[model samples]
Target: MNKGFYFERNLLALSRFDPALCSRLSGAETTRGRYRFIESRSGESIPALVDNSGAAHPLHSLVDPRREGKRLISTLGNEGFLIIFGLGGGFHIEAALEKTTIEGITVIDFDIHGVAELLSSREYIGIFNDPRFRLLVDPSAEALEQYILDRYKPVICGGISLLPLRTRADFSQGLFNQAGEAIKSAIDMVSADYSVQAYFGKRWFSNIIRNIAQAEQNTVPLAPVHSVAICAAGPSLDAQIPLLAERKNRPFIIAADTALPALISAGLTPDAVVSIDCQHISYYHFMAGLPEQTLLFLDLASPPLVASRSPRPYFFSGGHPLTRYISRYWRPIPEVDTSGANVTYAALSLAEYLCARNIELYGADFSYPRGTSYARGTYIRSLFENKQNRCIPLEALHSAFLYRTPLFKQGDENNSWYYETKPMAMYRLRLEEKVRSMKARIVVVPGMGAPIRLETNTGDNRTADTLRLFSSGKAAMGALEFLAQYRAGINALPLLQGPVYSFLTGLSKEETIIFTTLLPAAAALKRSAPELDTPELFDAVKKYCVGELEKLLGIWGMR
Candidate 1:
């Protein structure tokens, strides 16, 4: 029997497979090749064979699982076209494929020989055929990377999709080390090109009209509409989905492209979906039997797959003329400035565009209170279900690396905090601010036990009449703690002069309401009373209530 005819490995067999070693994986066999391959406990070969160069070990030109893992998780927030530079025998690719939100995976490993070895296996045939997984074979990492830049780069910066990371390396640490000088030269060449970012900006200009259209959408007269619920695998979602289900009658329902199957298995059906992913292989979940009304908003600059999508018209972003034209001639388009690039923001932006003033946020718990990700569902069940114990360390890295802890003395009640790591919170706040300032009487109400302040210049109204907590009593709260000392003294009285005089001193009646909420010197001496367990200060509370009412009135065209 010609042993040379037998291919050595399978990409889909499992992780932790070593071709040189034996494991419990059923029907697993060593290939007739002399190369090293990825190994699993079950002895399944991952088709990752390299010569006895021990090159799979870390090298100067090689990337490690940790760094690639970080990029993979970080881009999950964006959930669009995610491209990894080196295939590295699919370890990082496997890690990334684990994320549900990401629509596509483009493993651009330039080593043509390695890629050929990978695709030859029966297990890998599924990945090749899978819509969400794309495997590009080029001669070397550098060429493949350039091909990506020439190809995938524009798709990302048009605010349409994102090329999460573009790097140069051979998956074989030994091979990468041998090519260190070449890799260095390639890196220098790219870094020295100088016009890359500016070039991207120019290409992005082609999409500006959509940006303007989206900006104008804020002024559009909209009816009260329901939104899709975008959920993540975070454990906090476990608590929020029930509450979300209770209100499903209102919102049409959408989930992170990944969350779709999870929600469906949990007896839910989303009306639509959103993803910026470009690779043809990332469509597995989105293409699953969707709800009849399901509409997906795809980034226009995504891979050509977006242009070729079927059954339902996956609307391209409004920033693209093609997208705007389609929405104009054919049907209404879903183009809202999602809080950010991820599904969560996409859902929010779409909801806002639909004029759903009441947004009920659930399963948005980005925190791993229990240090676990993935709710109970079959979508991710294949990768993680049976291996939870083995996966806890990964989750631990995920929790620590992904979640930036609030800087505060541990256990201190004064340590106020929120998940600031998800910048989408700040983006949501900004969107609300824009909505409120508009003629539309819009109010965004989303909060946990803590108060999330909308940073606005309207605080100027409170600055004059508002009293500091320290001025009221010794119970100097976190504000005082933040200051480290009490110094409001006589200067504080002058700060209120503007609001106080405007409110009390012979100002016209019309002007009075505008400054009516400002507290006076006497109010500063008042007691600090707050609803128990709430963070609002009494003087702060009074001034806030008055300011909001006055602002509302102003919004209503009242004097």
Candidate 2:
């Protein structure tokens, strides 16, 4: 068979999966500088790259490339996603696709001309035809990162493994290294997000559904302010109260839920309070009673009991998929960044959303100073005090809270020390990262906890004098009516007639939106019942969600 026939077949197969890449390859100029085809001992064609010194480096073993491919792929353990850094001959990718456990495979390589040459040399239609396989040729670091972030669903794809074709990667070492870094960064973000979803998926759904009624009535928009002060519940908050109180009326104070009680105890009322936790324990922060005049900025997934604390709470959409769907379809709620996974970070996001020019952060200590878990008057301290007995003193309770996770003792240049758990350290790092991109000027008040290093200079203090907190779009219908429509949409979805991936990919735009709203619930269900297969899980989630929606509709009618 002519090589041209092989190229045409491969191009046709490639077009089915990635038309953009196929078009690029079709127009790409053939380059013959590095790679040359040679016959292996098995009488199969193999690619070898020639260096400047005239040394030829074969991508695979000259004896048996098929065996070598199997050996290389066998080293990876049960990872669902395979990120191959270099694509040389497609043998390893074929081997990867053979494993049922591998859900997806992405091949990243530099130089479109090189990839075009490979396609012309031999047939790769077998690999290209596989639905799970994709080729990203000559992608920039940002493009690769965004692709992984969008395509690699860790929930469906259990784990990720990166396989590098050593010889091919060595040829473009710098580019490959950048690709590796991008992949690692994307994986870290996806893994963190997936873990959160697995744990709070059901809770978030329940909370959002329960709060729909409140969200409909509480449509009062908050007016943006100029200067804002955010109060966290770190131990440093105890001493920072006086400073916060001095400028209480001067700058608008936005207190984190944990810091709300402490601020009120010091006779300082915040202009607004932000809460993001989906757990029921979040209501403890409001046990101290929310000030009637102060506005409440609650995440759509916040406990409904927390929403009830305020006469008309201001609901904002956090990073939940269902909340985002609601914002798009049900109503357009203001989106607040809660990706940092901590209330302090969410508070900063709320400040930015309010269009503040100069933002001052008080009690934003991201660690426990002197083994103090929280400032005086915070809910944790009071809860512990109430539970303490003869055997378990308040001090012991505090110590237990501080030592719940592995602690890393850290100190600043001023010799002040604090203890940080892994989660706290991550939260602080995430906040610092967020600060670098923020438009508002961030000023962290000095404290005894771990120092927050702000690398960027304060941003220009030119923000709008006032902005509306919520979008102009109102809910299309009442809460019960919306739930009825949503439940109907879920029911209208086609039954699973094929594989899970095919069924998902075949969904229309509106269907996709409806399906996406159920992902968190599906994640939660999967965690509780790991034995359920993908199709079974989808059916179960659909049934469970529809039933819940029905229950909500019934309750609304009774009321």
Candidate 3:
């Protein structure tokens, strides 16, 4: 453990934060066959790995590992989060930490034993001392996926990229490949969500302000129920409607927005309906008269007009980051997992939030059965029919709706053919994961789409007599006051005339939050204009977001 003064200083820094890790590293044992130090041309020693063939392979350059590391990092251009697949000597990780633009880095490597051996022989305290660095050893696909989902935030991180050490990846090819695919899966999932955020981030902030008046009421927690039925607008609902109508009163019925028309047509009444989409297209779902006694559960980011449609509408926070900030800072509300990206997913979450013990999913086909896009009496059919002309008949419109997107066919014609798409598949997978996590008897009725399997009988049913209230007291500041403070904060942000890093570092807490509201949009702008420098990007993002907010304030006449 004899290292240079600078290296010893790095270990001392790590010891201050993680004494346990330092003690473990001190006790670690490494053999020559496992790891050996190789001196560079600059007289700096680096660690190398020994292979099964008794050949030594340096983890870094014999000339200068630091130089090689910087070269590798330069290729990434600008990114907020970096995922390194190997922790060989920690040279690359140390280089990444030097970049101020990189907010965080996650290092994952296979074989914790081998990593321990390498740590024993090398001084990696420089890499370990960084507050932004995280280490994961011998992680499973599930563990890696969860870590990425939990740590990476597209709005805050801006962009994420993964880099793998070819030398080390080649040794544990199987594990590294699995890790790569898992990371890719998580990225794809996050990208889909980020796309949504990019489109509606500003709208979400505005919607929260508009919905604040509605959400100020005390949130009502649900009374425990023995059974609940979640109704979706999938094509299978055509047949399931009769059974649902028969047992409508047996279990509490929660219908998705799209399923409201189908359920109403079937002469059934649902106890509650959930809607999460912020787009105006969602208004069509409520074209039919809402049931008087039925409650409407709308995401705080939902279109403002949607809340006015129902007398007993309850506003809840969804996946929007702005809504999250409002929930934490202004007032808290019950949150529903809208990550499923569909109304049915939100409906199921509402049911879970209600503590339903026996939850049965109806019409959650999540596919096109026999090329039927929706149930028999959904709003689409009538809307298409009304819009049809001599050139385009009602049947033709229906056909076009079903054929709009190419679908993956599952099952044979003898049984039933179901069509699936990437979005549908992702939604089903997310729902399956949610069902497995919930400790309830969740059942998905046989449908025309891919089958959903959930782990049942975990025996963790919630039996609370009352639901937790989201808004316990009046907000510390009203919407107008909050908007005024936010406006001042946005206006006070440092101009992009200075260095990008300096401007970011100089931001006050309020300015930082305001800046967060701009990142998703900034990322979007950067994607479209890659030629823009960091300062130019920051300028554009700040100007665009602040201008938009200014317009909103002017329109509201609140300033």
Candidate 4:
């Protein structure tokens, strides 16, 4: 074997793609005492990590690292994505490549110098050549997070498993710990999004059909707004409402669904009200009756009946892949980020989408400030009051709502208590991310909850004048025709038992678009029946989605 030739080829490949890493490897020759290569019983060489003290920590079994790596990877079955926390001479990663047909494998290691030394010794051209293989040397938390978000596909990948070389991790404890935290954070974020999709995937599709028809009739006005106030239903709204009412006409007001009742009771009229919740209970927010001038903005995934509450309602597509598919293929609909999982976030997205330069946040506490769940006159208060009876008292309902989730204390203060569940925390974190990147001047009102820290860009005066309206012209195919074609497309999907990619690749352009509409529902089914194999799971999802679509078609026929 031409060992020197192989090393030169690998070095050239590294230099081409990772020049910075190649530069670090300039003279990374390993000393005899520091790292010794030992041959195993199976005739495979394994490198040992030696510290300043005489202790040597071997990453894999001394008998055979390759054999041990293959055994470990065999237990993982067929996970589409593999994440290795420590490189450990790349034995595990190489074994994973040899044993599994995974979508990708990510390797993270703290020591760039050590990696360079290892690269200089071994031929890793195979790992480097594979398009799916990724190596992150000494990656920061943000870099690790961004890489995971860009690559990890919860729907396509199914699940991801994290493998760590304990001996290697013990050598660099702090770095591995940080990398672990980054992985958990990224996974949690993706899981939360997928969970939402599972619950509302079918609902989103059904609502999009109705909302698209509604949008066709009454389009959202493409007007320019200089400034806007986004009102959330936090307890702090009680104090902010007076000030908001005093200067009501100064800025355009976009009230969240929960805040609409509070604004109305405070003798204030918002310019518009936005609703994104898929539940029927969202209807309670509009019981007081919507004003004539107050336009209603709803997500395409919202309860279809809510759109009928206002004659001037405009529908915008939220963070649903199905909604996006409809917008792309059938008709164009205004899209906004609803990922924050709260109406307040949707309201903020609306203001930003409309190009509101100066945004004043009112009652966006995100937490239940001082044990209060909602504003003074929010719909929850009236709903509980109306449902009050001998069985369930009004105070009981209010208390139950406030203390439904475990509360956590935020900030250092005697009375700074707030209800913070995992979902609520995710919502706050998402909003913080959104607010940080916004070009608008965001002003947050201080309240008895977690403080929002966002960097503002006051100097920039970007306007939405360039925002074009959706084409009002009739689509090439009407809703009925589109449904008919979609039904045929679903019916044409390849049968189960083969690889999912093979089935997916067989689909035409129109069939692919139709396939995405069922992913959310499929993901939901996959969650409940996880024991089913990929093909079987997909077949079940196809059947369930087809049934739902048929029901929608029946309803559309009656309309």
Candidate 5:
């Protein structure tokens, strides 16, 4: 076939898959001297990159390029999202598309001109036509990271792996290296999130549905405060209590549920308390008795018992898929950032959402100082005391708790020393990262534990004049009505008949939203089963979600 015919056929095929990419290729001017087309031993046209040293390096084998492509793909595991660093000849991508176990494939390459040359030289229509394939040309690090974050769902796509064409990647080592780091960062976030979902997905769904009734109850709106203090149940809380109490009512105090007992025991009642844990163990934090006038800010996924503790709990969305769905379709609940994966972070988010101009973080030490885990009056201390006996003393139990995970020791033994586990360090790092983006001036109280590094902005710290309160807007319908509609939407979804990708692509906007809402639960289901294929997993999720909705509807009917 002529070069014109080859280019046209390829562009036509790509247009059916990615019209935007096709348009770019159509308009892209192919730069010469970068890559040259050569005939392989198999009589197939292959492109070879011309290096800066005046030498040409073939991306694929000179002989039997198709066989080489198959070999490269065979080396990778069957499950997960595949990220190809260099588009090369597109043979490996085509091979990857044929594997049903590989959920998705994204081709990342720089230079639109180089890509256009490849498109013009040979046919990539087969790879483009596959629903599983995606092409990102000359994407910025941030753009690449965001794309992976948005599309690479670990629950649905499984794990992620990268394949790089050595010759091509070597040409742009710095760019490819940056891309690798971006991919790693995105994967770490997704994996952590997926791990949480796998454990709490079912519980979050259950809690959210049950809390909908409590969330519907009208609560007093909190006026935005200029200054706020967030109390976390770190080891330093015991030492920080006197200073915290010294402030009195000067600043609005928002206590993490874990720190509520410590604050209460110190005769300091925070203005509000935030709780985001979906586990039943979160109930222990409130066993200290919630202050009567203290407002409760509970994540929609928190245990229902925790919500019941407050006279009128202020329910907010914690970025859960189902809660977001509820906010959009049923009620507009204020969203709080719980992405830090800790209650302390959630409290900070609440403070920020309240538009607090100056924020003080007390007991924010994200480490175990002097082998201490929590504040003196926190639930862990009391629980350990209750469990201790002659054989296992309180000190022994404390030591065991402190040494449960791998610990990294910091600080000088002569002054003050602390041990940090992987999770605690991660929490600190995330909070530090979050602080850099906040409009509020963050002040971390000096503590004996691991020091928090705050990179607050020097610019104006004031946020919007007015902030949104929890459950501010009226719902279009009642909880029961919303559930009924959601149930019907799930039932109305088109049956999965063919490839999962094809089925997903065919979903209407409304249908897609409904399906997206079920993803977290699907993650949990996949974690428990793992044997269920994509279609079977979808079927299972639909049945499970529908059952829960029906059960909830039945209970609501009696009420």
Candidate 6:
């Protein structure tokens, strides 16, 4: 608003603060060596100091003492003003005046009365006379920040809010948070400046986190599991605990979070804990006091807050693409496709892969007919009302991704929704449908001898108690191991197998053949490029194969 002070830096941009405004308010009071404050009838008083002195202050090099003494000159910097809640003796003002090219500095304190006392001291005289600084001497955090916003709103708009809060009880512990948000919003509305980010010291640290699937899948040899059980904390697990305990030595035990506390109370410790929840709020039911050290099958993209607290955190990912990071870096486990499965489905997927033949579905009830499991750590008594829409309309999609009528959108309202479905009747109908489709021998051992008939394929599935837990006297490797063999076999005869490989990995049949044929000789490639050793070569091969296929297909031609 002054001749030199522009609201912006350039003609089109706001000057840092307002160089012209600093010069216009010079009609205060000053001397060549010592400055003094002259109180106007309108009750305006400011210390006169130097501006553009070409000399820095002895005590404070930022502002210099000026010959005229009405304004202290300083430069616009990462920090613009020194906010004194109580302007004491004008020492803050004099200290600030020993600089150059400053737009202005606002001082708020309760000691305007101290101005008279400061003028008597020659030490504070020269810097206090500068008009570039306005000393209000007000005393309120709200008032201080608000006044700063009102007067220097242009400069106060955006920056990392740094508040060294000093209080008796620290009630203002969250003040920086409240003020930072307001300032950021004001800055966005005012002008384009630095992109400001708000950080609260109380960002919240939890030794216990709710639900976030942090899975890290890699090509690790599958752990030997002669007999395997995917344990859930369902009421039915209570009925089967006796049987499970009797033969616990024979099987590898994996328990879902909820089942751990109870199962452990029964003198059972699981080898691993499987968590597959995107919802974090109600995850406490499973993880309230979980141990710090345990094998965790966690989602890779789960909130860092969840795994940060874990003693030894390994990751697994279910649906997130970023999950591969866990596999590439840390030891990982597979993220089983759990679209249509409940606890039983997840349990079975683990069991079958572990080579357990007599896989029994324990308490795989999809409905919460009663209000609760009649036990501790029950997550939900019934499904939320909105969840009805999930079952209401269903449409199938090709590939592993399912298109449920209402998708479980991230940050959606249903993330933590834990209400049960309509009733036992609806769940029974769907269960029958799924069981009939799965080509396996199934038996639903009813609790209390209730006749819960599960109609499976009308034939006996092979029952083999002899499970090969090792491959050639080594730890058994499952699907991932076979993938390498399949790839190498195709590479040896690309043209013949190209189409089939393409179709399998979602590429066209022709592309499959090309990819197969072009698969570079592994040992030869490594020898040609020293960097392409065992581990690196496999990934390189996968990458080159995918890239060639993608390029041939073109962006538009991709599936």
Report, for every candidate in turn, its global Cα lDDT versus the true structure: 0.41, 0.84, 0.75, 0.75, 0.86, 0.39
lDDT of each residue in 180-298, candidate 2, tens digit only: 99998888888888878889888888889999988888455656778998999998999998987776357888999999998888898888899999998989988889988888989
Ranking by TM-score: 5, 2, 3, 4, 1, 6
TM-score (C-alpha) between model 6 and the true structure: 0.34
Tens-digit lDDT string for candidate 1 (177-235)? 43343434543443322233223322222222222222222222324443334555444
Best by lDDT: 5
Clashes of 6: 72
- The order of the candidates by lDDT, greatest first, is 5, 2, 4, 3, 1, 6
Give the clash total for candidate 5.
0
**Candidate 5 C-alpha lDDT tens digits along 54-95:** 788888888988889999999998666899989988887888
For lDDT, candidate 1 versus 4, the one ahead is: 4
> What overall lDDT, based on C-alpha atoms, would model 4 receive against the true structure?
0.75
The backbone clash count of each candidate, in order, is 29, 0, 1, 0, 0, 72
Per-candidate TM equals 0.34, 0.91, 0.85, 0.80, 0.94, 0.34
| Residue pairs in clash, model 3 | 221-467
Off by over 4 Å in 6: 1-220, 248-250, 286-288, 291-294, 305-314, 320-333, 377-420, 423-442, 448-453, 457-559
C-alpha lDDT of residue 487 in model 6: 37
For model 4, state the Cα shift of residue 365 in Å: 3.1
Candidate RMSDs in order: 30.6, 2.9, 3.9, 5.1, 2.4, 25.7
What lDDT tens digits, residue by residue, belong to model 4 across residues 29-101?
4334545556667766666777888766777787877778888888886677889877766778888877535
| Candidate 4: stretches off by over 4 Å | 3-41, 45-63, 74-81, 86-91, 94-104, 109-140, 153-159, 166-174, 218-220, 389-392, 409-422, 446-451, 454-477, 495-517, 554-559
Error of 2 at 439 (Å): 1.7
Q: Regarding lDDT, does 1 or 2 come out ahead?
A: 2
Number of the top TM-score candidate: 5
